[model samples]
Target: MKIDSRAASRTLAEIGNWRAVLLHGDDAGLIRERARACVRLVGGSTDDPFRVAILDADQHARIEEEAGALSLIGGRRAVWVREVQDSALAGVMAALSLDTDTLLVLEAPGLAARAKLRTTLEGHRSVAVIGCYPEEGRALAGSLSGLFRDASVSIDRDALTWLSSVLGADRGAVRQEVEKLILYAGEGGRLGLDDVQDCIGDSATATLDDATSAAMAGDRVSADTALERALAEGLSPIALARACLSLMTRLGKVMGWMDEGKSRQEALKQLRPPVFFRKAESFGKALERWDRETLARACEAVQGFERACKQTGSPDLALSRRLIAQLCLGPRSFRG
Candidate 1:
């Protein structure tokens, strides 16, 4: 069974007869979070020695054998395998044939489309493959809100939007931040943007908005200041690049909608991860400065820089700072 990360919680609640699950994705944090969530749904605890058995990816034979073993605790039992790969596919397949009395949760890196492990589990009637990918936009915001909602921590819209924009690229980071926010807000406490700002400082000591908006508006001085400050505060170059990518991606869409004659308000409304109301005016300024062709080129440049940063021996921070400076030069500069 193929399940989406958004629907995993619901599916887990009604897991029915399914006993074997494969949770694999590029987002290790999300994979780990969902895998543990599944374990809890099955009435098993990861910390319980008697009810849980942790196995290595290479322990194929052991995985199958232990999964079928009766637990001494005489209640729910589960087998958790970490770092599964193609080599463990055969053993995983064999384990699925055993009883569904005990739950099996396997975690692996994202496999290729033709990978047998993904195929077999996806095809199995009693098996599930919960795909965990890096969530973005409204989905990420909604997930964050849901977590806070579960904790009964009330947060304002602006605060929620800011948190979503800054922290959701990493699931573990999001969880960690949310936990901190919950503690800061306390039970049943109402939280506003200031509370979030005080508790969860933006990466680089400056918001992505400051750097991205300044760059988009072609304010070289502000862009330089923000970029330098953010870097000094320990923000990763890859993270800065990603922030540029995100801004341009949205700006490009909004630019397209404006080209089609839609009102700026209407266009922004259509944007997922809805733009925070306070930032709308600046986003409009960005839209005015960027035409379709220029925005496309900007996106390409940012993406290229991202790839460069990932290469071995690259001076990622310096390269990213230079890119930010170039982008902040605005449309005419890029055109020239």
Candidate 2:
């Protein structure tokens, strides 16, 4: 049976009852973490040779054999398979047919929705399939807060907002960065915006944000220079385009709040990833220069810019330069 993310922890606690467990999703870190938990539950430790059999994709054919074999220590065994693939479906299915008490844990990241292996596992009566995907918005914020809370560290609201905006989509990478921050702030240390900026502020993302800010504020020279610097630092054109879209979306939210009769400062403060103090002036200027209608159009154009960058044989760099220049020059310069 398929287990939703909310019920995953409960299901994992009862992992011994299942013949097989498949953890598949875009979040490789989450999949690996859950897989380790399942392995440890069945076996004493993930590395116990007597109780745990570690297998890679190439050795998937041995899954059934290993799972059916009794532990030399006379306890339930765990066959932990990493990097599972669609080709491993036969072995997995065979292993699931066994009546043994051993637990079969498979870690398959990036599996598509219609993958045969995933589908078959989900339909099995004694199998548990859990999807691990990236968390976003409030979910991500809650996760960040929980991580800090678990460490007995308090984080300022502004600092949490900034961290959420800059963190990447990969759960593993996000966890690593958060762990680093936790170390930076000693036990029971409080984290503020300055602390987060000092530890977690990525130079590439800062440059890209600088470029987007400059472009929206109509500073052509600064926008071009920042865009070139960001690209030189190995940031992709698509990343810059997406950054532009994010800024536009934030601006739209602020404008929406203003339309609701909130003051400019009030609307700006209401932003989830509140504008950095240093960039507040630029962000405010950009807001003044854009009306709601024009901002909406700019958003659509940035979306097109992103799609264009993804096309094969496209001159992404040149396209990015042109788009930034047009944004800096205002809506009059925007093409249909």
Candidate 3:
């Protein structure tokens, strides 16, 4: 009952029979999407107040009772438990024992291999645990195809390649871009590379990429401009801050290699997406300004900022912007 990315499509297509499903991964968008798909396949709708129930981690104590209750609207019931982790395992186990037409969907962040909930769910015949990591290469291309196919949109190979590259790892972003493309294509319209270029070119993703690069490279003015553009394009501050944290984490790895006697060129060369030729100098400068320890601390700060952003009554956007600005100023400011 453990599903990898390659098998995700088939599993999603035939998910109706699953009594309990745990969708856990770092990709929040994919987890939510799959959780929603599970509800849809089981003939449940969030719009229906009585048939569908959404619960958070703290409300898990009610899960067992909720799952056993009959649907008021007279259809299959779905109980979606968000943020399921070690603490919610007890309630999950209780819900799993229910002999009813209820479908239990548990949405959680990335769980470790040895995680109790993951192990238990994967060991059960009636439970399914899907690992929703980011897809790449052929897998990414195939996912894009499936998405466009579901939308009933025709896309040429070249366009598919271009579109896939333009889209990021987030499934939600992919869904939004595909939805936009479908609207642009109208009914039964065939799309080409030019169509993708025209519709999704210079999007928030491109801007955010530029901003992260500039921010890490110590170019405050450029980073500020790019951040403004990204924010203007409707990219949330939390998303942008998370991107910055990812970039800094990558940069820290390169810095660690350099400290271990690797040349700047060699270190940058080792990066998966390899630093761009035009920005190699900036990356080198970033390395010169911050060391491994500082990057580690900065990562902690970014993580704390993310959590604070999620807390009730916090001005997440403003907090994210302020923290990002501090990061752009360098590790010295980050520590202060």
Tens digits of lDDT, candidate 2, 185-252: 98899999999899856556567778888899999898888888777866667667667877888889
What is the descending lDDT order?
Answer: 2, 3, 1
User: Cα deviation in Å at residue 57, candidate 3?
Assistant: 4.1
Which numbered prediction scores highest in TM-score against the true structure?
Answer: 1
lDDT of 1 by residue, 232-311 (tens): 76666665666787788888888788789998889888887787666677677888787888788878888788678767
TM-score of each: 0.80, 0.71, 0.70
Ten contiguous residues with the weakest lDDT in model 2? 165-174
Q: List the residue pairs that clash in candidate 1.
A: none
Query: Which is the leading candidate under lDDT?
Result: 2
Order of candidate numbers by TM-score, starting with the best: 1, 2, 3
Residue pairs in collision within model 3: none
The TM-score of predicted model 1 comes to: 0.80
Once fitted onto the true fold, the runs of candidate 2 whose alpha carbons sit more than 4 angstroms away are: 13-17, 202-336
Candidate 2 lDDT at 133 equals 79
lDDT by candidate, in order shown: 0.77, 0.83, 0.77
